[model samples]
Target: MNLRKISTNLKLPNYALAIAQDYLPSTFFQYDFKTSNQVRPAHTDIPKPNFQEYRRKPLENPNALSSESVDNRRAIMSLFSFVGGIGTLYGCKAHLVQYVLFLSPARDVLATASTSVSITDIPEGKTMIVKWRGKPIFITHRTQQVINTERAVNLADLRHPETDDQRVQRPEWLVIVGICTHLGCVPIPNAGNYPGGYFCPCHGSHFDGSGRTRKGPAPTNMEIPTYKFLDDNTLFIG
Candidate 1:
């Protein structure tokens, strides 16, 4: 039972050397060595697991479901996923609504969207200029003679034809946007070839007293803004 000599001769592990040193029972080694050579139990002879223990048991509550079917579990999970997705979309929609409102025009800007002018301030046969939406608006007080002359012009002679009566909201008032249709230049009031009309110096466009394109490169008449007379003296323009 000399452990150092046994270990050196057998080339056993350190644990085997410690066992041989600590456990000096020769009977244990002898019996273990004999049993190693004898017929051992086959793998099949080992007791099989009691699979019955793993089998599902009945629910303790009489009203409870005994087992959840595969389909039932899938249905529950699908319902939860659908509800979660809808909630996420609703949350995103709320945030998008806030962003849309943030980009809209301010209340003050919308409030000042229109302009008001006193029609009485403009003398007869004269033109007055006012600004609306960053564009010049022409408010002309036409004399009866000028109106009669403009109405006398034939529609066939004009480039963009329209009757003089159609251009004015009233017979005395001639309101139009001052931008020349040819090149977006401002036209000179009462200075064109046509009497008491508009002239675009940039491209030689001529407009008559009714703001109709009488001559030059202008494709159409001067634009008329949305306006109405609140009273004989008050005019509202947008």
Candidate 2:
């Protein structure tokens, strides 16, 4: 038969050659694709329409098609905006979670809670070193005369002087932070008076009874940590 002869002549690889050879015998042989490019070659198997052309289609009919295309474009833009918003929200949530829940709280907060202390042990006019809120607090009973003595001193002789009202705590007692204002060296209380004041052995910085930075490289007044008195005899420091 002719099929057997063609199959043998083409040297076909498999079933495709068989199909291509057999399909040409169909009744639609008059049809062929009108236009084509390299990507898609025109097919030659389909037949032309049997009936003749009756009426021409209208050109304005494409308005509905273009409107539908615009609608599709709007829908795509809305979808993109929604996706962008969601991404921004997720990024904000991740940042908040890291700062509020994960990373920020990891740092140790040095507080006065563990550092505060109370004592009835120190002698009058003598200082007792107690840790309050992680810093040293020097609490002095400031004898009955200490208040009078502080008031009687000449204000002109004092470089950094404080009146009774300038003190954060009650004026009758002297409560000062026990760190040196100059170089952060702890000052000794009764080390041969520089007009009778707290003496810093490291740099010889002197602070008055009110913890005012009187002499040396100490730039500011001795910092007063938070504290309140419990009663007449006891002190609550923080």
Which has the greatest lDDT?
1
TM-score to true structure, per model: 0.62, 0.55
Model 2 lDDT at residue 180? 87
> Residue-wise lDDT of candidate 1 within 33-107, one digit each (tens)?
211356888999999766555543442334555364546666778999999999999999999999999998788
lDDT of 2 by residue, 66-140 (tens): 554666667778999999999999999999987877544333553436343455666676778777656677777
Which sections of candidate 1 miss by over 4 Å?
1-102
Q: Which sections of candidate 2 miss by over 4 Å?
A: 1-90, 93-112, 152-162, 192-196
What is candidate 1's CA lDDT for residue 101?
Answer: 92
lDDT of each: 0.85, 0.66
Model 2 residue 144 CA deviation in Å: 3.0
Using TM-score as the measure, the top candidate is: 1
